[model samples]
Target: MAQQYTKKMIRQVFVQMLNKRPLNKITVKDIAEACEINRNTFYYYYTDVYVLLSEIFQTELQIVIDKYNETLSWEESFIVAAKFAVDNKTAVYHVYNSMQRETLVNYIYNVAGNVMIRFVENVSEGIPASEEDRKLIASFYQCALTEMVLRWIAAGMKEDPDTVIRRIGQLFAGNIEASLRHSAALHDS
Candidate 1:
């Protein structure tokens, strides 16, 4: 009888392969061999390996977001989210170098959005900024965070992630509150 493998096992094998080789060089047959699953089983679930890659990013990043949903600190949330890429440098580069790089970007965007919204809410407790404005602020920071992570990936991630995250926190310190206060004052006037 063939052994049954869960998607988590399949995903780990796929990511391990990604760490070792570029996405373009990875084949379903190779995945099957690495996974020790029948090619038929692989085919049954995905028409293309990229489909599985996309699914892995979406599922994994969503887990990160859900896990940090209660966190009060956006910077801490970003560090945790960014750690995935930092830890999986080769795999991340493989995905970033592929045609399906948008999947990676979307994952970062989702995490950034999640953290930023929570951050804005935490800081805007007594502020009079409309929910719309608060959301706008979160969106702004989300884009910034996404770009920061993308740039780090593009630059080969030579910088220590904690240092980078800490510097960002230092640079942006009080900026969110200032932005919210400005929005409220503008709204009042």
Candidate 2:
């Protein structure tokens, strides 16, 4: 519990600091001071600000995953994700305007990959999906999805998530399974 508290404190400090300045300008010392810990303690928790940002991304991804994995369609899941982005727009924009773009993109890649993987697994249950093929398809889908999201964020995240979700669902309707098959066929070709 104490450890959890410490981690939470660290995360809180990170959010507070990010709200105030660019990520590159915020040092481990700044985080440590804000969290009332020494640099060593900060190092014990995270190697650097990038790692800290990664942790935050994973935590947020897991929250969305854990909450709606079984209950939501892929479109719904994406809507939830967009909502998460919108809800945290301030923090996200702050991070976006920081030096953590690479870290942030990696985090989104993992999150989007996980979502695509799960969606494929559920929809393709009992269908034979080679691990390589699954990964490739997931990678493709994740890349596209992340690009869309990055654009959405860059545009100030102004569109309504439900509308965005519905449009994406319509655009990709039936293509999810078809795309997987097409990708598998291409791989096997």
Backbone clash count, each prediction separately: 0, 0
Per-prediction TM-score: 0.92, 0.79
Best by TM-score: 1
Candidate 2 residue-wise lDDT, 63-161, digit = tens = 768866665777777766666566667777778766677766776777777788888777666556567776777778889888887887688778876
By how many angstroms RMSD does model 2 differ from the true structure?
3.1
Clashing pairs in 1: none
Candidate topping lDDT: 1
lDDT for model 2, please. 0.77
| Worst lDDT 10-window in candidate 1 | 1-10
> What's the TM for model 2?
0.79
Q: For each candidate in the order shown, give its overall lDDT on alpha carbons.
A: 0.85, 0.77
Prediction 1 TM-score vs. true: 0.92
